[model samples]
Target: MDRTGKSDSGSSSMTTMGMVFVKAQNTPLYSKAWTPSTTGGYASTCIFLLILAITSRMLLAYRTRLERSWHDKAINRRYIMISGQTEADRERQAVGKGGEKTEVAVLTANGTDERVKVVRSAGRNLEGKPWRFSTDLPRAALFTVDSGVKYLLMLAVMTMNVGYFFSVLAGLFVGELAIGRYTGAGEGHH
Candidate 1:
């Protein structure tokens, strides 16, 4: 007890009740509290976060690379090919009977099967000529970075890990706030 010739105050400093006191200093509450369970839990959390973060990063990178490669290929191709919208255009063009030129065919998004009816110069204004020819695409969706859509999707999909981190932080913050609020509420009751 030394200096006081009685006892140390720090050991009894946690709280006071007139002459009585409750000590919390040097408590075992958290001191050297390492344990197998705690270690395992920490390891598991680390592994999970690492896996999720890395996978999210890699998947986004791979998809972005793939998309870029596709756009590059499309750019290299000089021919304009419509897809998904071509067939419909062809059908609409052919509606003018056995003769006549069909106009305004639906452009398909797919380039492989662009069909344009050849109109013959007879019943229709024109004949034996394709109602529509898929025109050269000035640019593709993936190539133009300014499309605004792919970029947003890429941003969101690429940063899933960040979102998860935010979620964790939000949970922790909320928990602390709630605890603080409850503690304050109890104090007010006195």
Candidate 2:
């Protein structure tokens, strides 16, 4: 305005156009400008993705709990006397119904089967055994899925929108607060 000594409307309009483009830069993925039509749907999508990422993390915590529980049950066991011998015998000979010595196989938490001296008690059965830890194949598949989801959520957050990124973080924080206690993170804390 000072250089030309005249009021200019063109410059003001150009400034407004720049502001519009700057706002549009934050549009959600696979979306157009943040119009009324797209706003609700995009917001819902972001919230869902964030919740899914948080749920996956929580599930990972649950899996770890299961692993720890299994370890405690298997290795930290009480002394059991089988066939008139203690666990110090390493392997106990058990006579089958047919009077033949049989080896008892137990599935360890690590998905590998181990031979253990087992007593046939009323509380024990093959189908009633404790839940086994996730096998390598299933664990790998879960990791892949979780990683893919997290990365996608990160990318959505990288779009630099206040709504999407904050939603993701809120979900994570809320999930931690909700399930952290059951996953051992609440222990030994004041």
Candidate 3:
């Protein structure tokens, strides 16, 4: 081992070997984290975390684009009838029960029948309660996956491995660049 306690192989082999999963039991930031068990486990762990961080960031970026496109498509779509009842059918149904024409003042809950406008606003807001788990299992499952992966990637950077930390940082930077390239490249200006 050299003065820094790293092997002469210039791969920090000393620090690589026998690296524990938790350096400080209380503080995760001070923890020297490694997951591999092979002779070159430390290097492998670093590389694996690096790729995961990069891929996670990239997936997040693409998800944003997908959400945008989905919003656009949803807003543009024109569903004349929501519950299989056409507009004319609704109007006819809205007529007086006794076949007498009565002025039926139709007002939306938000006092606006402009569905597209409402949909656009809804997309911008995260104001709705989550759907029931029984009826929307996939939503909950995906939510857990997304949140868990994101947090784990963040915690991996706190391992304090120089290689691992830099890999995550570089991944975020490159992922942002990739996302910007796909999104409006010149939207920064008025």
Candidate 4:
């Protein structure tokens, strides 16, 4: 080991096997093409990593929003079915009298009939095909992008550059602090 605790294999390469964090400018981040040759280039790489981390959090927020929307739609559909009301009926009810928003109570009383209806509805919706092209395609695309960003960040961290690692961490912190509240409590962690 050398003075910096890095193994001295007489190779003089910028890459090291040491566990210690280094600020080497020649370190490749994410890809060989991203190797920084100057202080400015290194700083830019750190900033890019930070931005990428923040973007990952943003994608998570968007995915959460999309999921909530789907849940709301499902609930609305169930409500319509259980109440035996058409969309036009609901709209007319909403526009009744003084323009005040009326809350419609959902019937959840225990009964075999209601349970059977719910089960039938669920079965029809599923149709033994859980993956619908309309819904699952967008979801799969979002997951793919999210996974790609996460893996990219992981690769950047594997570079073992102190500044790059901290930049990504700071981005995550800032992103969570800024956009996390809108995603609801404990939603982004998953």
Candidate 2 residue lDDT tens string, 11-69: 44222222221233236563555332465666676677578757856766766675566
Please give, for residues 4-122, the per-residue lDDT of candidate 1 as tens digits.
44456546424323432223222111124521245445444434444443343333344455544544443343323333545556676456455434443344566433343333333
Model 4, runs deviating above 4 Å: 1-16, 78-130, 188-190
The Cα RMSD in angstroms, rounded to one decimal, for candidate 4 relative to the true structure is 10.9
Worst 10 residues of 3 by lDDT: 114-123
Rank the models by lDDT, top first. 4, 2, 3, 1
Most accurate candidate by TM-score: 4
Counted clashes in each candidate structure? 23, 0, 0, 0
Tens-digit per-residue lDDT, 1-190, candidate 4? 6775456785553554767788787899866887999999988988999999999899999998887776545434432234566667666755543332344543456533321222112222433334557777998999999999998988888878889889989999999988987676776463
Prediction 3 global C-alpha lDDT: 0.51
Residue-level lDDT for 70 in candidate 3:
51
Evaluate residue 96 in candidate 4 and report its C-alpha lDDT on the 0 to 100 scale. 43
For candidate 1, the C-alpha RMSD (Å) to the true structure equals 22.0
Q: Which candidate order results from sorting by TM-score in descending order?
A: 4, 2, 3, 1
What is every candidate's alpha-carbon RMSD to the true fold?
22.0, 12.9, 13.9, 10.9
The local distance difference test score of each candidate is 0.38, 0.55, 0.51, 0.72
Error of 2 at 142 (Å): 2.5
